[model samples]
Target chain A: MKYCSHCSNEVTLRIPEGDTLPRYVCLHCQLIHYQNPKMVVGCIPEWEDRILLCRRAIEPHRGKWTLPAGFMENNETLPQGAARETLEEANARVEILDLYAAYSLPHISQVYLLFRAKLLDLDFSPGIESLEVKLFEERDIPWNEIAFQVIRTSLERFLLERRTGAPVFHTGKIDRSPI
Target chain B: MKYCSHCSNEVTLRIPEGDTLPRYVCLHCQLIHYQNPKMVVGCIPEWEDRILLCRRAIEPHRGKWTLPAGFMENNETLPQGAARETLEEANARVEILDLYAAYSLPHISQVYLLFRAKLLDLDFSPGIESLEVKLFEERDIPWNEIAFQVIRTSLERFLLERRTGAPVFHTGKIDRSPI
Candidate 1:
């Protein structure tokens, strides 16, 4: 940040007293602006044996297939955020089951939380941020066209655990080294 | 937020085009500042038949006992954040096991991710943010003096699941109504 949002004064980066890391502190107000990682929540909506996928119409892997997800909003639970993202992107209603996968992407400062959900009905269409929405079986999934590594990892685990009759919780990190 | 951090110009809250929620939009740079929830990560450090706790030396819950938890920083995974918090607050190094409980506190816009961990050794002392650090068995826990509801919930579940041999992944919401 170039300036403080509180006082419109220039901000300087320094480690605050008793703190190990540097933060943007306002010169006048001394307001510390701390930025933490954001969460991307979504669901694996299962209909019969198929799963829902949406083709992105926005940038950052636009036109690629993804399991409808987005940046979570304030004042909502993770499951609620996941369901809302599914509805916003695919116009599909779902009954959330369990939080299946959580991947920390330190490179992008994001955590991806994906849930296993059951599609309410066959009535689904593309929303504003999606070009198309469709259900894909295991063999039909476009693995090579998945939007993000986190999504691909979650999808692969979800599909594999589906055959085991019971799904186990999965947690891991996706580290992309700095240049 | 009063001024735009991008250009040091006044920012107004308005619903941008194609968006349903209002955001702080800069008048000079047209930058949209979006605020989302942050993650608080820590662990339930298990040592023999006891778990660790820290007496708060910081504000918001000064003097109250709590798990060694704090706001997660960037460039770290959930497990790493949990382990770091445990070490920083209690001077206790841990071997993180599984992510046990995830709670979404919408009222405060924070998510708590608590893990099950094994304390590496018995040599732990209070850190700067803690007045004292101690290990408590299930019957000796200071339930009423717990700092936060999320900590209480996590501790209760960890103790209960200890007898069951396996801890199921727990997810829930904490709603603190305005007084």
Candidate 2:
């Protein structure tokens, strides 16, 4: 940040009193701007034997297949954000189930919370941010074209655990080292 | 926010094209500033039959007891952030276990991620933000003085699930309605 959003004054980076990390503090207002990891919430929108996927029409991995997900917004619960993203991306309705997996991607300062959701019906199509929306069975999933490592791993685990007739929460981290 | 941090220009809130929600957009740079919920992470530190708690020395709930937690920072995993909070608040080193509970407090735009943790040793003391740090058994917990509702609910569930021998992930929402 170059200037304070509060006072329109220049901001300086320094460790605040009693704090260990350097934060952007406004020179005039002394307001501290703290940045934290954003959450990307989505769901494994499952039907009887298939799950929904969206081909992104936006950047960062445009045109690749992905779970319907995006940066969660303020004032919404995780499940609400997940379902909203699904509606926005795939025009699909889902009953959000148990959180399937959470992966902290420190590289991008994001936490991915992917839930297992019951796809309500087959009445679905692409929203504005998607090129196409389709359901893929296990064997038909385009593993190599998955947009993100977190999604790929979560999908893999979700499919594996389905055989046991129960799904549990999983958590892990994905990091891309600094060059 | 009154000013844009990117270009020190006046900002106006408007729903950007293709966005359902309004965002602060810079007049000069056309930069969109999006705000999202932050994650607060900590753990239920287990020491055999007891778990740890810290009496707050900070403002929001000074002198009341709470689990060690704070806003998660960048470049860290959820488990790492939880463990860091434990160390910083209670001087307690812990091996963070499975995430036991997640709560979204939409009223304040925060998500609480509490994990089950193993307290490593007995050498623990209050950190700067704590007035005192101590371990308490289930029956001795100061339920009435717990700092936040999310913490209270997570603790109650944690204690109840202990007898079942398996801890599954639990998720919910807590909202304090606006006056």
**Model 1 TM-score?**
0.97
Candidate number of the best TM-score:
1
User: In candidate 1, what are the lDDT values of residues B1-105, reduced to their tens digit?
Assistant: 999998999999999988889999997898999999999999889899998999999987899999888988998889999998988899899999989888999
lDDT of 2 by residue, B108-159 (tens): 8999999999999999999999999999988999988888888888888878
The global C-alpha lDDT for each of the candidates, from Candidate 1 onward, is 0.89, 0.91
Model-by-model DockQ, in order: 0.86, 0.88
Interface C-alpha RMSD after superposing true interface residues, each candidate, one decimal: 0.6, 0.6
Per DockQ, the best of the predicted structures is: 2
Q: What is the C-alpha RMSD, rounded to one decimal, of candidate 1? A: 1.9
Candidate 2 CAPRI classification by DockQ: high
* C-alpha DockQ for predicted model 1: 0.86
> Which TM-score values does chain B get in all models?
0.95, 0.96
- Per-residue error for A30 in candidate 2, Å, reads 1.0
